[model samples]
Target: MTTISRFTGARFLPMVPALRRAADRVPERARLPVAVGLLCEAVLLLWWLAFYPGLMSFDTVTYVWQVTTGHWRSDHSVAYDVLVWLSLQITGGLAALTFLQTVALAASLGYVCHGLRALGVRGRWAAAAPLAVVLVPSTGTFGIFVWKDSAYAIAAVLAFGACAHLAARQRPLLHWWLLAAAMTGLSVFRNNSYPAVAVAGLVLLAAMPRRWRRIAAATLVPTALALALNFGVYPAIGVQKPSTSSYYAFNYADISVAYHRAPQTFRRSDLAVMSQVAPLAHWSAGGSNCSWVDPLMAPPFDRPAAERLNGKLLDTWGHVLAKRPDLMLSAHLCRGRIAWALPRNDSDIFIQPPVVPADRFGYSRPGGLMDHSRFLPALRTDPPSDGLHSAGVWAYTAARTPELTWFLWTGSLWCWATYLIVLRMMRRRPLRSALALAATTAGLQVAVLVATPAGLFRYMAAPVLLGFLALPLLTAAHPADRLPGADPARRGRARAAARPQSAPPRSGAAA
Candidate 1:
């Protein structure tokens, strides 16, 4: 064969010219990270442009209010608002915030794609990493959307990569530190994320290699940082004071359900305690809406009086629970259903309208990106990213198609997937690291179930993202496949391990 033909065959001949030129720009040492990063970034960029700037919900508008007014509140995530505040300060647009999260989404998926190769996903599976990250709407359409859930969900992806790498027996120097950073993000991004992070941390610590225990021990830096941030920094900044009314959703729902089920048997004093928060009629109105608490808590609900009389409210809630555990159980299932099952309410499952609602809060000043947000007008079908918008909408529709819904939208499905991965990993050595992921994932699921105020998919975003990314593991080639003959060039030197090592390694290695 001519030298040119041989060179052409060896180098980039069969690859598409555009991608070949793009790949040539990346250095060999950084190729995997850069390639996967760019691929994921490209998908997110299209989503952002298609939705131009990104998707938002009512909560996002509220976040904008906090960022615009600088009156930080803890009801949502103050840390996340701080990030948006910083991005707006630096780039003068909320789109910059969108870009920043897109980058994070890229890094997270990139890291997972890279680490999965070390955990045995190889050959075609390895080649499919970039596509895998884009396949799930959680990974594809998530970053461009504005929500604190996106931040914590990205953190969970980072943590999953760390756990996978640690379990690979090829833990990089950055593994534990990456885990630490993810934990800190988890602790700060959501109020309920603290206990979940703690649960995951303990599981990781227990599952980590004994020799690496000290190193893994340092990963708990987030614990102290989380405590300080929650207790110290937040208090010093006067972020948001604790309130007994935080539990009002669940407790009030229980009381409402009890009243609806059997109001005649209920004591008058207990009913009076409930009345201090809202009228008996209001309770009945909201009792039927187990999916949302707005009707019971809105307007005339008298939050101050509820706070003042919280002790009595709890006592009443307890009395109802003891008298009618089944009613409370039914209420718990309805309210926290998203965490453990496919949400029955169609509206609750992945509602990302491509437009940010009009900012009603005067906090959103005119003449800024927030104003541009107001003027989004409509997505032009002829615009460049409008194709992506169409494609994403198509994918979103596909995601709801029976089987895909379980994989893409269901939280418990991913939680179960996580346990299966844990079981697979547990069969390997350095046993402690196996449970790290399960802990983070299932722990979050439990936390959401216990404290959930409504049946929203964002509350369980972490599992959906992490679960889909790890799917290749079910048919993984075994980390050993990446060694020797796996690379035609490396096959020459690897012959000494002998036995002709084969042209390419297959999924011969064990779990």
Candidate 2:
């Protein structure tokens, strides 16, 4: 005879009581952090178990090859490759790396949730904000996926969330260092992320009211670290560079589209330069596929020859862009459509079946490319159990659902939304500090648009994750009052410290 409303209010999950009891033991001000920590860690544990060694793809296999073979390259994220190496050494597999990514993400979002709570958001909802951000189909699936973009998204969230936390109240120097680490780590995990993190640091400098010298130093951390690692440390340590031809992949698209649409558009000399890239057939055939430039630059494409003729290719592409702007621009836009306008791009990068492909790890199955003995003893895949199967089904369907695809799966939408929100929040002076978060997302969007070889869903992940985390910040409420049993002196000072920060400080004011 119990009503549905009663069940809605009921704590049916056994873990709820334990989490509540644990939170109750902490001081009132510290309760949210403790709860968030416990919740994030607990959920990640279950999520990791279901996927076991964690999700992997061709890129992961490459990383594994590097680790197992002892040959390393800087084409991919070398720092991230080292992380994979460490995880493999510790767990003898990739599970630990996935765990690190998910936990770090949950921890970062928890910081932002706590900041929202401090800003007077409702207690339960603000505490649950990180849970929502991490548990979404796209994000939850990515949690187990072994990709640098996943870690890149986590670092972006950390940098963004840390900025929100620092802005919420008077924070210690430790908090600034936290932001510094997140910003620096952002680029280290993704080769193309330096520009985004660099701009984000500038956003930090502008948003912060004081501490110019210290803030400037923190701002330069990513720039300095990125440059030193790329130019000095990498070469010093013997990290071989990947094919330089890949660096200019996008140029292939420009030249291909021009030759494809009109063979006569190019002069004899231009045609000669074009052939140096790939055969005319590769260009014409690859033109039909604009999602990526890989087809145009595929096997038998003479990569070293292309590298030598880089100047000629650049000239050809530049000529195409100048003379046949329509074709070139359309091709570029089509290539990067996922970065600008993929509302229905439900293709979450979760390694869909989460099974080992037939062509990897000393195994071969139907439809697999081939088999290799690389991951023999170190890594293997699990047969999808009922729970894992159900979860995969959920992730797949939830991604395709039209209702969620536009908002959750499509990242470009979030990027545009973040910019719009930043513009609106600028009118509310006290909320301007949040622009630092918006700027980081915006910068990432720019990076993907300009540099990404393909418009993959993973490129837009940061904005998607941040969009969900930003929801609780919209709540309007008073800050939680101090409980009677808490330390009165400490609570009083905490409230006092928080009150002054409510008013936006003028530029050049002390921290």
Candidate 3:
């Protein structure tokens, strides 16, 4: 061969061999983490290419305002706002935020993969598990979206992984710390997660005697810290207390119940407070629980007035429910179905070329861009490419289809299913600790049912993601046998030797 040919051959020849050798060097057990990490990087790249800096919703804009102005809002998590502020300071835009989220998600899922391998899943099966999770539309697609829900989901998975590790090994100080950190993130990232962490912590304390002290500390520390930050520290630092409209957690339920069951539930005096923004007829004619409270009655009430009215309305709500329990229950279930049963949520959740209108919430479009420009310059000029934008539209469209929609919509059902299945599985095997962790994670959906107003998929993303990821752990054949430091090869050989053999292969050649 000529010198040029030799050079070309030398360059090209090692590429395949190099890949094979690299693949061989990666232990079978480590393949799953590597694969998950690569998938996460790919996802981050696709999102960056598609949305450039990042996608934003109305909430995202609000968060930016809060972070930039130092005017904290109780309606949103201060912890999350602080996170965004700090991240923006370092990376200068949503790019860094999204990048960190992708890393978090990859690490969380990799931990799940580690747990699966530790639970006796074959290396190949464990490697394939994360791919399955990634294929689930609600999981992989919504995961990359820029929202507090994304962080909560990552935290939830990390907590689950920590629980699985503790369940299997029942030792290791690192796992305890990991659980605490994960729980802290899970609890603080979203307000609704507070109760879920509380419930899980209680479960851990009650069920996990071996690690109850550590678990209790893990659970309580985060819970207390979250409460302090949200209630005490935030206000001390000049963060506005959440307005009464935001405080009355069950406003939607109260309005829906009153509209449907007791149209006369709200006194004329109470209606007078709401009438500043919406007519009594509007509250009475409420078809949707959300419509009755949001953009209408609730917006009219300022902080102090809202606080008084909410107190009165809550009492009235109680009386209405007492008189018509059946109707009230039905209304609650109906509203919850919107959150838990509907496959597609509001149209704007993942909108491409995000519609930040000029007059939205007192911030003009240009002003908004200028405001965010300090951290995100690409927001002004880099609209998503046509191909990636189209791909996003297509993916979302596919998610809305009947089959895939079920995964997205039925997250609550899956959580319940996981809880029930874990309970049953625990009875037959040594999965008490892991099962308890999963059950608590699944129980988070119940909290969503109680606390959330409308069924938004983002609200339940963490629980749904956790339930799906827990399947391998819940169904492992020999969970205890696969604890850390146990020898998989030795176990495999032992199983092979124990199997009955009809005859030896000694006579194969002669016979």
Candidate 4:
């Protein structure tokens, strides 16, 4: 007569043995699959390094210069610079530097694989599919390239792995603090990453209350100090450069604005043209809005560098919030759009010439090229294949390569959907979910070619890694029936239930 619930309650502690036995049944050598997967990934990394030898598109040159020169001491992305410097010192060539990056990424991927295995995802075969899907896409391209994106991806995987371990194990305050510091360092390394760290920290706080405030405070203090060192103390000491007030004139702003005007269909084409022209126009228009000015754009003698930057960052936020609140919201909302933009399958640089067949003649269409409404048709046909490829080129074609256009369109849509899901989820658990949401959103803001509009998929790499780490946690299986603790009263009731009713016993005896 023992009820199922009663039996379950008595077996709680003993279930551990059952679970272990189950785990043991999962083949001792299952790790071989993961090892092989890593090997394949390593091969891909090596091949890309050998063949591409550093694709000449987007931030490739600028980042190389930053590491080689070691100028921007307070420029935030210090870790990546340090890694690059270390590579240059050791190997003595940019190719060597790229190899170093690939190795770092491999290490990060290894850690991620370990984390997945720890979560009961047995065998490499089980892990390979998800890992391949994420590692490929635009992310794969970044893995092989030596860029901030690669470094960010590496640091992010490490940080997130650390965080997931800390969270899953319910570790001590000290452990959480250590992970927070590591995350802070990574965030500082990439300017766009700071907001993401802030957001993610808040999300972690939402989930664990015992040490939530302590964890959040620990994270914020170090981050604030890092910001001080980068924008404030460093500039004051002349270790870093100061800023100027000319950002509005920068072409990125104009491009962002242009995107605001365009419908979602051809945002990639719009961003492509803007990426080429915006910064120059911003520079020509005269001001320090371009990120390059962070080191060289010194503050006037009237105020301390830290104070000046604090004021500027504050003012920038204030202006955006006050004058363009809607734009700010739109930007965050646009994270969804940015996330799903399709891969424009076009070459990152103008290396390969236009390959359209003569039958695809609509590509040669003219007129209405400048208009947003005509933009999609133009992008579909013209394929701007080699038209205005380099950063140095002056003339703007307004036409986008068809493949590139489709990629952006697809990437934008995917980003938007994820953004909305994150947003909706965060509303209920603000502290815990906000960071994931923000990281997903803001990370996309920089990831897509639209906001920062870098060609390499590396820009959005942080969120990409985060999404990977989040997968296991999201799909964790619920214990069908969590065994309850043994209770004497419940045992007594079950014993009583085991006895037959007295009336029935009497009737049987009479018969």
Counting clashing residue pairs in each candidate, in order, gives 2, 1, 1, 36
The digit string of per-residue lDDT tens for model 1 on 119-219 reads: 55653454365456565665567776678988888888888887777766555668878877887888888887766776776676666646346444544
lDDT tens string, model 4, 395-456? 11222335543432233443454455444443533334223323333433443433342333
Error of 3 at 509 (Å): 12
* Model 3 Cα lDDT, one tens digit per residue, 1-511: 6999999988999798999899899987677677776875576566555555555566776787677776678677777787778777777666677767767777777877777666565655655656555565457655555578778878888888787777666477987898899889877888777778877887776558776778789988998999888878878878898766666746634655566556666566656555543455655555344312343334333445556566666765676677667667776665566335544445312223333344443444565533444543423224358888667656656666655555554666667667775666677576566555573564476667667665566776676677677666545656455434555534576766667887756677955
Residue-wise C-alpha lDDT for candidate 2, range 85-150, written one tens digit per residue: 898777777877887777787677677766666555566777776787656667766766777877
Error of 1 at 166 (Å): 0.6
Query: Which of the two, 2 or 3, has more lDDT?
Result: 2
Over 4 Å off, model 2: 1-25, 209-211, 325-327, 344-353, 361-374, 377-379, 383-386, 401-403, 426-429, 476-511
Candidate 3, position 102, lDDT: 69
User: How close is every model to the real structure, measured as TM-score?
Assistant: 0.81, 0.82, 0.82, 0.53
Candidate 1 segments whose C-alpha is farther than 4 A from its true place: 1-30, 127-130, 209-220, 345-350, 358-404, 425-432, 478-511
Model 4 score (lDDT): 0.44
